[model samples]
Each structure stands twice: as structure tokens, then as C-alpha cells.
Target: MSKRSNWAVPYLIFLVIFVALPLILIVVYAFQGQDGGFTFKNVTNFFTDGDALNTFAVSIEVAIENTLICLLLGYPAAYILANKDLNKSAVTVILFILPMWINALMRTLATAELFNVLGFSLGKGTLLFGLVYDYLPFMIYPIYNVLLKMDTSYAEAAADLGATPVQVFGKVTLPLSMPGISSGILMVFMPTVSTFAISEFLTNNKIKLFGTIIQENINSSMWNYGAALSLIMLLIIGLTTLLLGGDKENAVEGGTV
Candidate 1:
């Protein structure tokens, strides 16, 4: 691996400076307290704080709901595109990914603005729309790619054997696309969990999310609290990645040449 070229040196240097160093610093700061020595006060305080717990709950709820919503809508679109006539699939793929080109913050704001135009006002409901709108592309693209890569023969054989189109889809296309669906969920899940910008700008401070808690703590120089919450958020996102194993098994099943 190291024989690749001169590129490895700069890439490794960048990783150390940008990723490894910062992670180490966060760990060091979180565990050290007022005496400039390591302590557990930071993590302990996080549990005792009502705001921290509340924000964590809200963030989890939002991220999970967002994942489900994306899966619900994205699955059908991805399924269609995957099993589509190749001649026209390109246009549909482009359309699904089109919204991603727009800035996420801008798209989220536009959603809130849309609600205002309809006299609906903005709040949690508007936030839900923003979450779905911002992350749907993430869900669709992975699933689409997976579906596109599937063996067309499987679905064809099912149909030839008297299976209805829906049955073929249920047993073949959808199941195979699970890999991409798993990836998309993880792709969308982590950011949605840690994203402070959307919650801050959209909900107008009416709702408290875990990301906002981190932001609030940092802004107030509550470094310890921020660190604790940051660690918890990271752990949660890591747990979500474990669910992606279902995709790997599917990939292995059909990957044989």
C-alpha cells in the first residue's frame, strides 16, 4: 500500500493534523477538569442536567424519524430506477440527485419559507420537511446505485415463473437493494444526529436538539459538557453504522464472479 506514490506522505500528514490530533484533544479536554487534571465531573454533569437529556432525546427522535421517512419514500423511487429501462434511467437518476446540488441550508430555509407562504408557519413540522428534503438524496442515491448493480436475471426469472411484478420486486429487487439502503441510512443518520445548523436555523430555538446542546455548551465555554455530549453523539452514530451489516451480507451473497 505504501508503494503507491509520494501522495501517501501528504495524506498521512493531513490525517494526523486534521483528524487524529483533534480527536485526541477532545478526549483530553473532556476528561480534565478545573484542576487541570483528569476527572469524571464532565460526564457526570451531563446526566444530571435536564437540558442535556431533553436535547439528546429530541435529537434521537428527529434522526430516527428522518431515517424512516427517507426509507419510506426513497425505497420506491430507488426500486423503480433500479429496475427501470436503461435507456431512460439516466434522466430519472439525475432528477433524484438534483436537489443535492442546492445548498442544504438554503434548501432547508426554502422549505420553511414555503410553509410561510401557505400560512402554515414554521416549527417542528417544518423541521421534519427540512430533514426529509435535505437528506432524501442521500437515501436515494445509494439505494439507486445498489439496485442498478443487481442482476436483472433474478427478477426476470421470478417473473418468468409466474411471479407478479410486485412479488418479483419484493423478493428480489428490494432485498438486494438492502445494501444501498443500509448505506443510505448510515449516510443520512450520522449528520442528521449531529447537525446543529438545521435545527438552529429552522426551529428558531423553539426546539432543543443534541447538536444544539453541543453548540450551546461550546458557545458558553462549557467545554466539558460539550465534550461529554459530543462523545455520546459519536457513540450513537457509531451504533447506527452497525446496522449497515445487513448490506454487507447481501453484497457478499451476489458478489461472486
Candidate 2:
């Protein structure tokens, strides 16, 4: 084998052991009953149980809101950063990423304390603020990377053709940056849907999302049900990733040609 192939052997082994094995176990447990008999009851409970359904709805709502907020905020910030003069842009980008250097748990706790001090009660609103704060960087970086690499010639050409600044941005910049937008949405939405920590910390356990439900079930020894819930979440995230990633690939390919 080539040296490159040899270099991949360790990573392949790690993937199989750490990723594939756990997924196989989850699938197995998802279909198994408490007595270890195969059954679909666990999956059925997710839909039929009112609490489970509500939790799922709440998670979806939070995820959608967080994703939209991130996109709305990140896009303009990324655009400004991408267009700034080199030195200033570099410093600004560093400042934007600085929060990521701190531990996530610490940041969440800090947010919680800050909210408490400001008289904001622990609830969905605080939870959302934490999620947006934590995941906004995920949205910004992807869009910024795409914008930074975009060809200036396209915008120049449009402007030379007598297109106004707004027209150039609408017709050229936004379309070309769609791949990054898709990527950012996927990044923010998937984690927001599945994250338990931010909700737990910021809401002080007052809010129960789908991820919280899964965690509670697992902790309460309802392994099969928890696994089933996890499987459903996995399916939703996988489908979303497939749809958005396909769009991103198409946009990238079109831009290339």
C-alpha cells in the first residue's frame, strides 16, 4: 500500500471502534424490548406518548429559531468581515472566535449567571439565548470561509454591467454564498436540536427538549426507549444533512463551472 493508505489505517480503526460500533449498538438496542426481545414498542412510544411528542416539538421549535437567528446575525457579520481591509478583518475574525477558546460549560454557566443577575428567569428564552450564543460562531465561520474564497471578479463584472450594489449582492454574492449558508444551517440546527447542556444550564432544568428526554430516559434505565429516540433523532438529522448537503454540493459545482 502507498504511504497515504498506511497513514489512514489508524483513523479507520478508530472510526470503526468508536463510531461504527456505538451506532450498531444503538440500532440493536432500539429494536429490543426491556426483556431483550425484539419489538417496535420503543419507537411507537415516541409518537404516541404526549410528553415525548411535546419534547420533540419543543426541540424542533428551538432549533428552527436558533438557526434562523444565527443566519440573520451571522450573514451580515461574515459579509462585513469578508469585505474589510486585511489587518482589521484578521483582528475582527480573531475576536469573533475568541469565545470559542473558553470551555463550553464555563461559557454556559457564565451566561446563566449573567441572565440571573439581569433578572431574566430560567426558561425557553434563556435557553434560546444560550444556544444562539454558543452556536452563532458555527454559522459565521462557514459563511465567512465561503465569502473569503469567492472570486471578486464576479461582483466586479456585475458592477461593470451597470448593476447597482444591491443588484450585484442579490444576483451574485448571495447565490454564490448559498453553499456556505446551507452548511451553516446544518451545523447550527443539528446540534441545537440534540444539545442538552445549554438547556439544562440556562433553564435550570425547567425546559425539557428532545435531547433532555433521551438523556432522562437513558439515565432512568429505559435504555431501549432512549435508543429508539436517539435513532429517530439520528434519522431526522441525517435526512436534513442529506438535503442541505446535496444543495451545497450542487451550488459549489455550479460555481466551479
lDDT of candidate model 1 versus the reference: 0.79
Report backbone clashes per prediction.
0, 0
How far in Å is the alpha carbon of 62 misplaced in model 1? 1.1
Q: 131-183, model 2: which lDDT tens digit per residue?
A: 98998888888888888889999999999999999999999999989988888
TM-score of each candidate?
A: 0.89, 0.92
Score candidate 1 by TM-score against the native: 0.89
Give stretches of model 2 more than 4 Å off. Answer: 1-7, 85-87, 247-257
* lDDT tens per residue, model 1, 64-108: 999999989987777777765643647877888899888998877
Query: All predictions: root-mean-square deviation over Cα?
Result: 3.4, 3.1
User: Against the correct fold, how does model 2 do in TM-score?
Assistant: 0.92
lDDT of 2 at 36: 89
lDDT of each: 0.79, 0.88
